[model samples]
Target chain A: MILPRLVFESLLNRRSTIVLTLITIAFSVALLLGVEKVRQDTRYSFSNTVSGTDLIVGARSGNLPLLLYSVFHIGNASNNISWQSYQHIRKNKKVAWSIPISLGDSHRGFRVLGTNSDYFKFYRHGNKQQLDFEHGKPFAALFDVVIGADVAKKLNYTLGKKIILSHGVGKVSFSDHDDKPFAVVGILKKTGTPVDRTVHVSLQAIEAIHLDWQTGYKNPAHAVSAKQALKLELEPKTITAFMLGLTSRLSVFSLQRSINQYSKEPLLAVLPGATLQELWSLFGLAESALLIITVFVVLSGLLGMLTAILASLNERRRELAILRSVGARPWHILVMLCAEAGLLTAGGIFVGVALYYLIIIAAAPVVETRYGLTLTLTGLSINNVCMLLITQVAGILIGLIPGIRAYRMALNNGITIRL
Target chain B: MKNQFISIVMLMVLTACEEPVNSESLQATWEDLIQEGFTPKELILKYQIDTYEADDPRRMQLIRAMEEEWNSAPVNENLDNKKITLTGFIVPLEIESNAAYPTVSEFLLVPFLGACIHVPPPPANQLVYVKMESPIAMPNDGEAFSVTGIMKTESVNNELAEAGYNMKGLSLETFSNESLNPNTE
Candidate 1:
């Protein structure tokens, strides 16, 4: 008790320096934990975007690019699969269900996905969860569109609202399809996926809107009214990609091989789970690099504490000599120094964790809205607890440096004021 | 007091020398999982399946007959409900997509690696569907693991219908070269 009191009083004597060291450690700790949390959540949200589908088929392209463009809406597909090939593949007995996706249009900044009602029925995400309607129902008429949660909220769209789509996938486009506007028939619930930022319309509506733009430009002479365009054949000729659910998972490899070998048109098929793992492994390199850098930041923080303690030892030599004269032992001084380090580390960890929660609470919504990544407020996982334990032990181990030096000084100058 | 201390140390050493009595005793190999009196090679030989040319119409009939024999091949019932350890490569069935690391809770344990991609997967009886209580970091491709569990002869007719055996895995360890010939000792 007396030794702890002396250590506490000693720490208080240099309050400013100790507090500064603690703040450095706290900031470093918070940064380390924040990076790890965001990395974990990003991977989680990425993987949760699509599930239960066995294969994603698209025009011949790299698997990663196809996955990114079709599922994540991150890029454009290199080419479109002919509607004939999609029909032929979906007709195979092994295919349980298929959902065709046509891209290359946008409303405001959101990508417009042209698909049939089968998407609402068969498409799954995040543990096979089905998309539920937040308001209204799936599109019943050809001109009716279903907006995702983000589009509805960001654009302030309601049921029966009229919105026109652009000719291409850009925020600002000159070729606006002002001739044919879609009615918002439904809004999907928040899914924390790219689906939340998409605008869904029927395939026929896509064809209708692009009727006059067949020559890559809307000709004034050939302009067709929206009502007249509906009377024409609105069958889609090509699609960006399509997802397949096989009757049996055992046939996935076989079907994928056959799709890749389709002689009529060059095509590519990839198993979603396997491709996702491959994609994540690529990101794993960058994730590890970030973690390593943050770890070094923490190491430097601990080293700063060590330097502060070691520098203070020179000024505390007289203090130790006085204590020795008052009958304090060398080991007592050692344990007291270690205890002080332990206290600073523990205090820093507590404030760091509190600061971590504060940042998460303040930034989670912004992260979710801006990046579509959900930052879950989970309790300290086993990995976190282990890291904190290692940091605390390192701090105490660092204390041993100054501890042994002070021990030597106390023994060498017993009962002498060397200052 | 010195004698007592030496005797206590000796007792500890003796106890440490004794091997632990493991509850699981049956060490099932790929050969043991096969149904008695049934072999794909024997069927192929008996039907002259390899003798016909690829374009021959008779060859398709013989191949279909061989497939029927393969599909109807039953699991070895004697090993049912037995506590056993089997070593094999994994084919993940239930991937936890949200994990930072690739994690799987359910997977198929096949006798050989690359069974999923390679043509003509192993017989149904040779594939064991293993379900772990919790998800574990998925092993790299072609890596093998030895799983200890209670084996069942029941069929799992889920999306992955290739499995002829189901196992409630209790524990697992990475298969090493030393464990390759487990019965040698």
Candidate 2:
């Protein structure tokens, strides 16, 4: 009981240094937990990007690249599948539904996908949830287009707004499809998937906009007004990739086999789930590295506290001598020093958890829109509880360092008149 | 070259002379086939919608049953050689024309909204093989249209599927949005 009062008085004597120590530990704790939270949320959102799709088919390419282009819209396809191949596969008896995606255009860094009205009816994300319309309806005409939630919000686009697309997938491109601008007809609700960053147009419009170009040059003779182009055939010659949903869930492998062995063209069909698992396995190495780095950072923060407490021990020598005169033992001095360290660590943890929530609330919107990651405000997990306990234990171990130093000082120094 | 052009025009004019049966007098003669133990519900399950993974045992069983039923379905002989006007979604199987003007000449008419594109192709009986003499322009993607033609109870196999019925289509026109999907009829 007396030891508690002594510990409190000793900490109060050095309140400024103790407060600084608390702040440092709190910052470290926040960083460590923040990394863990972001990692979990990233995995959740990425895996949830495509659900209803069984296979993502594309022209023969690497599995990761195909997934990147078809699902994430991160990169361009190496090759394009012939429209005939898409039709043949789309019409397969085993294929319940297929949405052909023709990429290669962008509007302000966001990918532009050319598809049909069936996309609105069949495309799903986040555990088979169909897309909902925040405002307006699906594209009805060739020039009508639908913008994703992030696109609508970031670009400030609304219904009846006209937007032009660039011919290439660069952040900025000189060649623009300004002649055939599309009007935004629909804006989908936020999905926290790559779909949120896409701009959708009719497949015919994709063809219509490119009618004037042949071999990367705009031929003046082929140049026609949007109305005139509509009169001509708008069948797509090639598409970047397509996703297929089978009628029978048991026929997925068989259909994937058939698509892989397709006689018309060289094609590749990857099961989205399996490919995603493989991708995550590759990323596991980087994730562990990040975890290890954060852990070391936390350890260093605790060491800083130990250093602060040890430095203050020099000035507390006289205080300890005076306590010794008042009948305090060596162990009492040790307990008082350890108690102060424990109090600072516990206070730091409390503040750290509060700060973590504050940072998450502030950054959730930016993270969701920028990275397509949904940082759900989940409660402390079992692992996190274990982590907190470990952090507290580490603090106690660090506290022992200064505790031993003060114990030795109190034992060696007497209540004599020596400086 | 001029002579070839004139001959092609003459052939087109002759083929276009046949009149489609008036919609008022024409009746779907194959409507009886649908009544004979034919419900799309039995062939498909509600849980199977929008799923593509081939891991469900129930889905496999249902698909096998669908294929079996499709093979055993009896075609109506009365529907053969009859002129009718049918509305359904078009899946372009073949586009034919000179380089200057391309039009869809051979296509499949499906009975549902997303039959050929979004969903698995419907059973063979539900699909109508259409061959047009004067190919019409391809309509909007997955848009249903009315095809007036002489229906034939012919089985034709393509890379896509085996179509149970064929039609010699004469004219094609866009369907009014409300008139599509003769699910009731």
- Model 2 RMSD in angstroms: 21.7
> Tell me, what's the RMSD of every candidate?
9.6, 21.7
Each model's TM-score, in the order given? Answer: 0.85, 0.68
A305-393: candidate 1 lDDT, tens digit per residue: 98999989888887887788788899988988888887788778888989999999999989877777889887777778888888899
Candidate 1 lDDT for residue A134:
99
Per lDDT, the best of the predicted structures is 1
Deviation in angstroms for B46 in model 2?
Answer: 40
Give native contacts recovered, as a fraction, per prediction. Answer: 0.11, 0.00
lDDT (tens digit, per residue) of candidate 2 on A1-419: 78877777777778887888888889888888898887777666666677757789999988899998888988789899999999888998878788988998899988899998788888987646898999999988889999999999888998999999888888788888888878999999988788888999988899998888875877778788877886888888988899888654334544776787788899999876556655666767898999899889889889989999998888777888888898988888788878888877887888888989999999998887666677878787666777878988899878999999888777667776256
In model 1, pairs of residues that clash are none
